[model samples]
Target: MKKERQATEGLVGLIPRAGALAARAGLDWFLLALIGMILLAWLFPELGVDREPLSLGDVANYGVSLIFFFYGLRLSPGKLKAGLSSWRLHLVVQLSTFVLFPLLILPLRSFFEGGEQELLWLGTFYLAALPSTVSSSVVMVSIAGGNIPAAIFNASISSLIGIFVTPLWMGLFLTSSSGAFDLGSVMGKLVLQVLLPVVLGIVLHRYWGVFAERNKKKLRIFDQVIILLIVFTSFCESFARDMFSGYSLLDLTALGAAMVGLFFLVYGITSAISRLLGFNREDRITAIFCGSKKSLVHGTVMSKVLFPDANIVGIILLPIMLYHALQLLASSVIAQATARKAGWEATGE
Candidate 1:
């Protein structure tokens, strides 16, 4: 019995190392696959596949449905209850998400006046209209010692609200470009694609919540894989449709600059607001995460509904994709430094 117990203890010690190795291997494989897909999409646009025009709307709908179904599965009543109690933190986060971003974008439009300016404006608008991200926001909040449940609630609710609010914002701004802002069509799509699946998942949550909670780790992996697929497919379509044809290195540089500016600006504003409100360490962390993030999932899904034109959709997704990558890298570094500082403070070292 002693010998068997020793062997089990040894196995348990290996689990973390094994898990890390598997993660690194999986990421390598995913990157290789992404590169391969991009190449295929670019090199062989019509390799046995028909060159018929593709509809961004259909793809967007499919992606949105899959994305939200998984989102619903992850949310729980307990999380919601905890988040609701922190109303002040929630208000600051939501305001930063919906209000401050849009205000910033209006003045920046003049910089890209001519030459693919529409694309630039569309990209900026997409960033503004998007909601706070779910995963990364929560991760950062956890790192900053923030209210985790509030971050989760704010992030999740942002996505749901963006389903309607994003379209309304776009319609107001892109009226000439998008044409006849059809609220009915937008709402119908939201109902059929997003709300329906989420409702079903919520209904099943009672029976499956325990299983979901138990398998949360596994489900997160599955969610990431699906997002990777969505990104791959969307990029492939953009490549196949020759969306990058006229875009130059200079244009990309501008887009990058815009993304960097937007992120820092939001971060500064949120931090200031938190300070003004006299929030504790945790609430400040929540504010930073919730304020800084702009959801690629929401943007991708909304672009399809709001901008049916594939070219427009491609352009709208550009800054969002850049922002997503930038935020992940930036926030990871910040979160680690903050965590280390927290540890030091706790230890009085």
Candidate 2:
């Protein structure tokens, strides 16, 4: 009994230490949550997908609206205006995010012209068209001693622009290929589900803005949980339909490599452009971080509205998920390294 008690205590003590190590290594808890949710979906699809009283997918849909509402509540128009003076920086970042990304992926259209690989290209295009991530971009910029205001402005504006632009980009080809994609319906849903909540939140900002600000961390967690639930239902549906059956090990490996390559390619281009524009280090950091990221939250939420036909969604989601994981890992390392270098320079190393 004494030996067993000591053994149990030892095992319990290791867990928190292990978790601390993971945190120090910059492993995001939300990513772990995502992987766990995917596993749970694989094992038990019915819980989130078709459970009796309340389908969790419906809950996630509502959560998406609330998440955006809080996002709007946190964004101050005054701050946006203040940051707008940096027009050159803003232009470069926005163009890199919306234009350059798709153009880089355009060559792959020929490479993946047939069969299962075609979906990979489509997914890559969708990933390209996504807005820069808000929270992560801001966080990394802050860490790297970047211009926080510009990062905030660009990230927030990117998301707002993406609400209109992303769908338009995807609609171009989706109309031809699927023929089921209705641009009008997508815009309507965007207006109702996404845009309305954001407008309402902004209007009520005077009342709840402080509260939202104080609870921002909690709200971020709430946003991530909603995303995880969406991933759960999406994968559950995919598993049920065997939507991932066409993908092999080699295909997944190639997708991951493509995602990483895309990140670096954009990162290099933005860095070059920022240098050419004579941006300071802070502005360059903001531009690179904001311009290079693709938002998983927006992608997942938009997927629900854009792809009503559930059959192809798993394939559609695969590249973005891979890209999401890769960017988080890569960007965290870059941010930390950049911060370290800044510190060294400050000490005149």
Candidate 3:
């Protein structure tokens, strides 16, 4: 736990130095904020666990619906239609995200067969099962001079796809492990919370789309607020329940190292596949970047529904949060290097 606090402080202290780049990538400060939120939860568990100082958990639930609604608002049908021409690119990217990632992790399932390590492995698998993120993935691809249209399309489509696929992938384990998740029931609720809000927003896009786009930065802050609430509440429950009691620094180190390894493995595989497919420079960059990302937005909100056992939700989220930070740092450096080597400045266009 001390290790985490130290790490968190180090990350948070970098916020000032990264001000310019953070505007484009956004993950740098958000990563620090996440660590701060967790530390806050540790200091005052009652803020989340006791349902005091306002019902934040309930508010976060409402925020989830609004997040999707705004998501649908930004996604115009014409943009989606225009990006559909690259069928092969789409196929490889999506498979790399939803299929290839999970398959690579499945081989390690045997090592965590019924022990204290089971949940750790399950959390790692949860990270793999998540979708590519939106803003950051597009930003990274753009910085690297990648296929922007295809990146936007793949990232958007991946979120919608994970609305079904992520839960289904998780169901395979939940059904046997705890029997808490009713696939049919969860699907119904997801349609109401996730799908319905999205469809409604899409329907009203013509009317409110401009407003949403104009205030996108504010909307993104709203998303960040909601994510912070969820993280605080989740960690409050875990801390209150003593989930981290005996969790050693060595374990945290191992997990961090493992997440980095997982990232490289997926990234390497995607790069190889992109080369084999004879993709152009832009297309290859799009494939590798989009294929390697996992969305923390989807991870936290979906965990609200998927894992009802609030105490362990924090543990389930641990892998994604770490992966989120590492990916941003590594991707930013690589993106800058790629653009520099290509003799072009990253205009973030």
Candidate 4:
């Protein structure tokens, strides 16, 4: 027991520095965990407990509920108010998340027609429909010297809107492709799991808000731990259901290729738009980081709400898992490059 405790303590000790490194590197630990979960699903199919489908689903639902509850707890009304001051930047970020992504995804549907490919394409569309990441987007904006308040507001709002918009968009697109989706059921889950907790937090903001603000650091830790649990449970379900039975090396390669293409395409478009809009170096940095990201946290939560079945959930999350890794590696390199260029330009080197 002493040995086990020390080992656990050592791992906990590393989390702070590891989290700092992850932040500096422009990567999110949640994204890393999502990737790790996917690999675990592939490696150990029989590891997690075999529970009834509804029981597993209930666990997933509760996990998502707790996640958003903390999301609300951590949010400061003052910060949100301050962030809203930069309405123009917020509009741009929100529009890019909702409008630009859906338009881009529309044309790609035809590329995936049958078999697992169609499911993968649906996953891609789901990825595109989701919101920009919260922690990573804000971190990247900070690294690139963008408007921090605006980043916070836009990221938070994106997740909120995604609870509704993502499903609505999917229902419209996937109905013909995958039959009529249960819009009522999806909306009910979103309301209960996502929106209610947020509203509850906001209502109790007057009392708990100060406490939440004081313990922001601890709340963040709680959030990350909850996310890790969610990832583990989701992967366990996927493995138990044998959802990855037919997955192969070639399929992984193809998924990786698709993820790469999607990342570059979005990044290029956002970069060009920033340039065309005459945004300064800072705003451009913000645009590139914010516009290109899709949230793994939101994606995971929504997968449960939007795609309840184990196989569909597994497939829908695949591209998102791949994209999460690609974005981290790609964005880290790009941010570093941009930072170097900015330093040189400032120094007149």
Per-prediction TM-score: 0.83, 0.93, 0.91, 0.84
Local distance difference test, per candidate?
A: 0.74, 0.88, 0.89, 0.78
Ranking by lDDT: 3, 2, 4, 1
Q: After superposition, how far is residue 92 of candidate 3 from its true place, in Å?
A: 0.7
Q: How many clashes (backbone atoms < 3 Å, residues ≥3 apart in a chain or on different chains) does model 4 have?
A: 0
Each prediction's total of clashing residue pairs, residues at least 3 apart in sequence or on different chains, is 1, 0, 0, 0
Each model's Cα RMSD? 7.5, 2.5, 5.7, 5.7
**Sort by TM-score, top down from the best:** 2, 3, 4, 1
Per-residue lDDT of model 2, residues 1-349, tens digit only? 9999999999999999999867654577887887898789779866766867988888988999999999989988877887888999999989999999988887778777877789788988999999999988999999999999898899999998999999998998788777888899899999899888888988988889999999999999999999998888888888777777788989889889989999999999999999998999999999999999999999999999988866566678888888888888888889989999999999999
- Candidate 1 has an lDDT of 0.74
Candidate 1: the clashing residue pairs are: 146-282
Model 1 C-alpha RMSD vs. true structure (Å) is 7.5
lDDT for 343 (candidate 4):
85
Model 3 lDDT per residue over 177-266, tens place: 777779987777788988898999899999999999999999999999999999999999999898887577888789999989988988
By TM-score, the best candidate is 2
Ten contiguous residues with the weakest lDDT in model 1: 23-32
Cα lDDT over the full model 3: 0.89
Q: Model 4, 1-349: lDDT tens per residue?
A: 9999999999999999988887766466566666686677567645534554445445656767777876787777788888876665667777888888878877977777766577778888888898999887887777667777777878888889888899899898867767868888989979988899988887777878788879777877766665655566667767777776667889879889978988898888888877888887777777778888998888878777677665557777778878887888788877777778878898999
Runs off by more than 4 Å, candidate 4 = 1-32, 39-49, 52-57
